[model samples]
Target chain A: MHSFKAVFKRELKGYFATPIAYVFLVIFLFFAGYLTFRDGFYEIRQADMRAFFSNLPLLFVFMVPSTAMRLWAEERKSGSIEILLTLPVTIPQAVIGKFIAAWCFLGIALVLTFPVPLVVCYLGDPDEGLIISGYIGSFLLAGGFLAVGTFFSALSKNQVISFILSVVACGILVYAGMPTTLDYLSNILPAPAVSVIENMSIQMHFHSLLKGVIEFRDIAYFFILIIGWIAACSIILDERKAS
Target chain B: MISVKELRRTFGPIVAVDDISFDVAKGEVLGFLGPNGAGKTTAMRMLACFLAPDSGTATVCGHDIIAEPVAVRESIGYLAENAPAYGEMTVAGFLNFICDARRIAGKAKKEALDRIVPMCAVGSVYHQTIDTLSKGYRRRVGLAQALIHDPDVLILDEPTDGLDPNQKHEVRLLINKMAKDKCIIVSTHILEEVEEVCTRTIIIASGKILVDSTPALLKEKYHCSLDEVFRKVTRTKKSA
Candidate 1:
């Protein structure tokens, strides 16, 4: 736990130490607001957070991966990974510590969007419960994508490659649960297989929580996905250190 | 104290650290002389618990590296080549983070920093970002980091690789000052470093031990200077 706090503090501070935090914050807030107001038609529609919740998966497709791609890739490139692992910290502790730091940074960025919800409350009567659920769901989804990003970052030493690969991998997960994508799969495959594919998509689980219904299954799905990816990341790190 | 028995490591078809064994006791500086890619770094990595060997076992401070890697890591301070550090961090900040990682905190952490900063002559650059510091200062910060915990074993891989002659002499002096109570391993291609600071020297080639003896004994046996002995030994292994 002590080692975890040490790593977490440094990694979190690292984000703000460079221009990465500012760049990420500006890009995240700009696109999130633009996508919600433009596509969801915030002015033209009812005063609900549906637009904000619906756009989160797409926004995270780009933002969360950027946050995670640097976790290990930068260390490897600069040769600091050797220093990190050789410390009294274990590989799993380092992985978890970094993951928490990135996750918390994303959480902070998400909180910065509080003005959107405040505006919704000002405009008209909206489902407060739904908005809160949407925030929880969005945070979970961000974690899922960050885990995928962390895994790919550990797999590659190049940050650009790590970013591109994570974006593509997360894209597929988000793409898998789209209604149109499921419709297309249904025509070629059997009903059970299509359902399985639909069930596996990150968007499907995320959408369930956005409905203001905090189901145990939905939360478990994200936890399982995040833990699975982080485990793979730890394995990759250990293997790379050995070979 | 450190001991290795039949240690071996391979990278797919290439053997980076072939079967080799040696022991290093306290109060001795073992100069690891080897050509590039001759498994010097790999062996140090194994002893430092950064890399695990494929076959054989090594113990540091009486703890098995494989069985008690975290304990092994706790007892050794390893400085890799080029002295890598976070570019954006100040020397003090980096050392503080290392102290935190080493699980030292509060007053003890401050004391550790206080002891090493002046010992390494890094006080001037305590506030400057590491990227902005010169190469010699960066190496000093790296050395300072390794000495922060004052571990029983010190594994420095090319501690003075790209320094000027005066900087190299300064580093040698630092090593000499710390040589009495620690098992120090300084891997270098420079033969002069062996004579200057190392009490014993082990020359390796092709991932194998070419010679392991005291500097004076190695000179007497080869009937030549340490530089010529290094060239001849490494050259013969390359051709063989």
Candidate 2:
């Protein structure tokens, strides 16, 4: 636990020590706000963050990966992975510590989108429960995508390769949950298989949480996804150590 | 304070560290001399608890590396070749992070920083980001991080590899100053370094120990200069 806190503290500060954090925030906030109010037409719709919640998954497919791409890739590239592994901490502790720090950084970026919610409240009364749920769902979505990104980050030494791989992986999860994609799959595949694919889709679970329902299954799905990816990450690091 | 018994590490079909065994006692500086790809770094990596051996066992400071890696790690300070560090961090920030990772806190942490800054001669560049620092300064910071916790065992891979002549001398002096009461293993290809700082030397080639003895005895036994002896040992191993 002490090692975890140490790793977390350094990693979180690392983001601000460079311009990467600021660049990611500006890009994420701009697109998130623009997509919700301009593309989704928040002014015409009811006073809720429905559009903001809907657009976040797509934005995160690009943004979250950017945040996570350098986590392990840069460490390996610069040879600092040696320093980290040699520290008085297990592989899982370092992995989880870095992951949580990146996840929280993403959470902060998500929170910075508060102006959208404030604007909605000022214009008219909104479903505060739904807005809060949407924020929770967005945070979870970011966590899930960041996990995928972190896993890819561990696989490569080049941040570019890690970024591209994560974007492709997260993109598939998002599209898998789309209704049209399921319709296409349902034509050839059996209902059971199609349903399973839809259930596994990141968008499917995130969309449910956006409805202000916060169902157990949806929450459980995101948790499982994040945990599974991080576990895979530890396995990779262990293999690297052994070889 | 350090012992290795029949340690082996293989990468696919190639063995990197093949059935090597040696013991390093307190107050002794062991020079790990080897040609490139002789598994010197790999051996040090295993000792530092950064890599696991394929077979056999090693212990540092009375703790088994495999059974108690955390204890082994806490008891040793390892400086890898190239001295990699976070480029975005200042020297002081990086040292603080290392201290935190080592679980040093409060007054102890402050004292560790104070002692190491001057010992490393990194005070002038303490606030400079690592990316902006020269190669020598970056290497100094790497050494500083390793020495921060003041571990019982020190494993340095090519400690003076990239430094200029003056910087190299300073690093050797620092290592010499810290040699008392600490078991130090330094891997290097430079033959002069062994005579300069190592009380004992182990020359490795092709993942095998070619010779293990005191530098003066090895020189006397070979009846030649240390450089010639090193070349002859590695060359014969390559042909074999």
Candidate 3:
């Protein structure tokens, strides 16, 4: 618990001490604001926040990786990993704490886009439940992408390599369920395999959450993937130590 | 407080640290003397439990390094080379981060913060971002972080690797002062430092221990001074 607190605090300080946090905020909000409001003539139809929520999953694909790529990769590249590995804390605690910190930072960036929903409410009687559900979905989708980035950050020592790997891994997760891709594979692959692939797609899970149905199954899916990838990360570090 | 036996490490077919062993007593300073690629850093990493031994086991404060890493880490303080702090943190912020990661908190953390700030001369650059600090200041920050928790054992790889003369002198003096209660294992290519501060010294070459003895004894055994002793031990050819 103490180590976790320390790690979390340190991560937060890392953000505020550098311009990465501010730069991310500006770029994220610029895109989100532009997408939601569109120049000066705001014409986002529907009571639901489909415009705000759907773009979030896609935005996280690039933005979250840029934020998380340096977390572990930079430490390894510059050799601070030796210092960290020899610390009193365990690997799992370090991994979990850092992961949570990045996720929380993503949450903060998500919150800065609140004006979009407020504008929607100002424009008309927006469905409050739909906006809230969209937020839940967006949060999970961001968490999922950040987990993938963390796993890649553990694999490579260079930030550029980690970034490239993270983007590719996240890209696969978001598109694995598309009908075009599934159709291309269905002819050669078995039906059950395609079904399994569809179930694992992050896009499918977020779509359900966006509808204001925070089902346990979707939550469980994101949590399981996060735990599984982080477990893989620890295993890699453990194997490196063993050898 | 430290022990090793026939420790070896191999990457594929090449041996990096071969069959080396030594012991370091509490409050004693042992200088790891070696040239580049002589397994000095590898041996230190193994001692610190950052890497595993392929064929042998070692212990820190009587706990097996391979079997009890958390215990070994708890007992050891290490300053790795390159002074690798998060570039996005200030000096004080980085030290605080290290303190937290090491689980030093409350009164203990305050005491450490007070003691190490001056000991490392990090006050002038307390809030300066680490990414902007000069190499010498960065090195001091690294030392501060390593000493924040005040562990019983210390492993420093190249303490004066990139420091100016004044910085080097200060760091050496600090190590001498800090040696009162802690066992220190330091690797340095500078042979003069061994005579100045270390009670015992060992020379390694090509992943093998070439000589291990007190500086005076080693000088007498080779019938030469410390510089000559270093040259003789590091000679590429081995004695039959």
Candidate 4:
């Protein structure tokens, strides 16, 4: 636990020590606002945060990978990984510590979008439960994507490759559950296979929570996805270190 | 205390650390001498628990490197080759991070930092980002980090690789000063370092130990300088 805090603090401070944190925050906020308002937030004629929350899965598919790409790849590239892993910290502690720090950073980014909900409340009477659930779902979605990005970051020593791989992986997860993709898959594949792929998509669970109904199954899906990917990351790093 | 038993590791078809074995008790400064790509760094890395051996296992401070890596790590300070650190972090920040990872905190953390910062001569660059510091200063910062926890064993790979002559002398002095109570393993091709600081010398070539003896005895056996002794043993190993 002590070691976890050490890694978490170092990684969080690392994000702010460079320009990456500020640049990411600005761009993320700009896009969140742009995508929210660009889709005619006011024109939708709903005083809820549906537009803001709806755009997050795709937005996080791109943004979370950028934040997570350097988590391990940069350490390997700079040779600091040797020093880091050699410390008393265990592999799981280091992986989860970094994952949570990046998750928290994304959480902060999600919080920055609070103004959208505030403005919704200002404009008209909005469903407060829906807004809260949307934020919860968004945070979980970012963690899900960040976990995949962290795994890819450990898989490759080059940050660009890690970023690209993460983007592709996260993109598939987001797009797999789209109506168009599921419809296309249902025509060729069997019902069970199509549902399996649909169930695996991050958008499905996120959309469930966005309905203001935070079901246990949806939350479990996100938790399982994040934990499974982070575990894979730890295994990859351990294997890489061994050979 | 450190012990190795036929420790072997390979990269695919090539053996990086062959079936080699040696041990260093506390208060012994073991100089690991070998040519480039001679498995010095690989052997040291295995001892540091950064890499696992393919066949055999080693133990540090009564903990096996493979079965008890975290325990082994907790008792050793490792300075990797080229002294890698977070470039964007200031010297102070980097050391503090190491302290934090080592579980040093509160008054203990402050005392550890206070002792290591000046000992490694990184006080002048404490506030500067590691990337902005000179090579000598960065190396010192890496040294400071390794020493922060005050572990029983020190695994330093090429500790003087980037230092000036004066800095090198100071580091040698530091090693000599600390050689009385800790088990130290210093890997370098610099023969003078072995003579100046190491109490015992192990020369390996092609992932195998060719000669393990004191510097004075190795020189006397070869009837020449330590440099000539290193060349003769390593060259003989290559030709044979």
Model 3 per-residue lDDT tens digits across residues B92-146: 7778778877878889889999999999999999999888999899889988887
Q: Which stretches of candidate 2 lie over 4 Å from their true place?
A: A40-43, A241-243
Assess the local accuracy of residue B141 in candidate 3 as a C-alpha lDDT between 0 and 100.
90
Candidate 4 shows a clash count of 0
lDDT of 2 by residue, A51-110 (tens): 778888888889988999999998888899999889898999999999999999998998
- RMSD (Cα, Å) of candidate 1? 1.1
CAPRI-wise, candidate 4 is high
User: Candidate 4's residue-wise lDDT over A1-243, tens digit each?
Assistant: 999999999999999999999999999999999999999999989899888889988888899999999999998889999989899998999999999999999988888887898899899999999999999999999999999999999999989999999999999999999999999999999999999999999888999999999999999999999999999999999888533
For TM-score, candidate 2 versus 4, the one ahead is: 4
In the range B53-128, model 1's lDDT, one tens digit per residue, is 9999999999999999999999999998888899998888899999999988899998998899988999999999
lDDT of each: 0.92, 0.91, 0.83, 0.92
> What is candidate 1's lDDT per residue for A172-234, written digit by digit as tens?
999999999999999999999999999999988898998889999999999999999999999
Clashes of each: 0, 0, 0, 0
Minimal lDDT window, size 10, model 4 chain B: B116-125
Structural similarity to truth (TM-score) of each candidate: 0.98, 0.98, 0.94, 0.99
Q: What is the per-residue lDDT of model 2 for residues B1-240, given as tens digits with 9 covering 90 to 100?
A: 999999999899999999999999999999999888999999999999888989999999999999999999999999989999999999989999999999999999999999999999999999999999998998899999999999889999999988999999998988888898799999988888889999999989878999999999988998999999899888998898
* Candidate 3 residue-wise lDDT, A126-217, digit = tens: 87988888888888788888888988888877788989999888889988967798888899899999999989999888899888898999
DockQ of each: 0.78, 0.80, 0.65, 0.85
DockQ winner: 4
